[model samples]
Target: MNPPQNPPQDPPQDAQLQADTVWLESIRRRIRSPSQRNPDMSWENNAADLIERQLQYDGHRTWGFVIYRTTYASDADWAEFLRRLRFQMEDMFDYFNGRDILEKFALTVFEDRSLFDGASTDTIRQHFQQWSSTAYRTEQQQQQLEEGSGSGGSAGRVSIGRSPRYRFAVQVDAEALHSVVHDAPAPPELDTTKKGWVKLIDKSWYLGRSEGKSDPLEPIKGVAEEDVGWMKVPYQNVMTEYYTKCRSPNNWSLNYRRPPKVAGSPFD
Candidate 1:
């Protein structure tokens, strides 16, 4: 008679650990080279390079500015432009070990004319600082409740709490500005302004918890609620995935699965 066959067995724990290590290494490689994942247009790349260079040398500064010009024929085009900008900023922040610092970042959009006419960066900066302070307080309160000994109070509070990320401010409606395209080779009469001017500043003024802490380099999973108000339908769905599913550590691993894209989503 043939020898009795042995029953099948699960893989050894060591083998599983080795597989996980390999997967994590792959993710690290990807994070190091974001350009390979999303190739930017020539102008877009230039803009991103400018911002990255500024951060590299003057990252300690509380605020900075960049001039951006884009040609958008429709609302969809505008949305795509904003989405690309978001991704580029995220990559730059991660590259400089500013992932945690990103929470204190704020963006303000402006028309070229306003910069030369009457808009004040100081006023905008002050408002953003106030908003960031309120958000910080809210988060602290929630944390305290989560750590409380009260049974019922902390019960179903096991749910993950929300925290503020990026905040944006604009004078006019985003959709209304879709038709205002700026493709001029040179900036307008104002030497310091471009058709599209964006102010990127730190609301925390380098006084937050992330002041000296460095978070692990990783991809930004979703856009903040304040940013979603400026995005279109497809981008909104992307934000949903980021807020709901991508927040978990398990989703950061290589085995994480992305949800199906919405009908017209530009993302893969």
Candidate 2:
């Protein structure tokens, strides 16, 4: 019977189905591939990650950090960050791994915002000492074994400076805090019209104070509007540029920073 009537050949597989969760149908692109994204640029250990782990936020209006001052902007506005405190103390801390990847020092938790605030520039060194103290007990045990000629490896020492006073949560999650910052700046929660309230949402923006000079409207000492590294900038424009990174930088000189969720979160 002519090998039975041959069925029509099936068409090629859909490009969509070939890729699993790896493919984003909406954007039609790979979610994230190592080659496409730099691993060093990620949360892995490097200068950025090291600096980030050592970071502590206090909501205080301090230099080089996002600080919120004033509980009220206008008579009608009685507003301030709720500043919810959270704690996440990991049982173990590990960075990315590779035989070639080695760091002389490791970041350690000294005391979550329970004890210090990173308000001082010397905060880094302070926390380093705190970490050293905590790691002392662990070091002693290893030292004992090594003294007896046992090959027990020595734990790398950790140190930190006084942390900027972040909200007091005894054990804090560095990852969660990082996420909270990243997830912040959404619409309606922040509105730029409020006075005396500027948000330094990005960490990089507050490194320079002088570029294109002018006194920031509320050049509150230690609380610059933004950092214009290695240049003199109008201090007034710092707050303006901060919001612009999120929504409207062109609307410069708005004289206020809005909540990231301001589109509907009360500020709208």
Query: How well does each candidate superpose onto the true structure, as a TM-score?
Result: 0.25, 0.24
User: Of the candidates shown, which would achieve the greatest TM-score relative to the real structure?
Assistant: 1
Kindly report which residue stretches of model 1 are placed more than 4 angstroms away from their true locations once superposed: 13-15, 18-59, 62-65, 70-72, 91-98, 104-110, 113-268
Model 1, span 1-268: residue lDDT tens: 9999999998899999999889866765655434432332222233333333333342221222222222223556555446544564565555444454445344433434433233333344455556554643444345546556465554222211222122322322232234223321121222122223222222322223332344333322242111111221122112222222222334322222222211222333
After TM-score superposition, the amount by which residue 146's alpha carbon in candidate 1 deviates from its true location, in angstroms, is: 32
- Please list the C-alpha lDDT of all candidates, in the order they appear: 0.35, 0.28
What C-alpha lDDT does candidate 2 achieve relative to the native structure? 0.28
Q: Which TM-score value belongs to model 1? A: 0.25
Q: Which segments of model 2 are wrong by more than 4 Å?
A: 1-151, 155-212, 221-225, 228-268
Residue 25, model 2: lDDT of 45
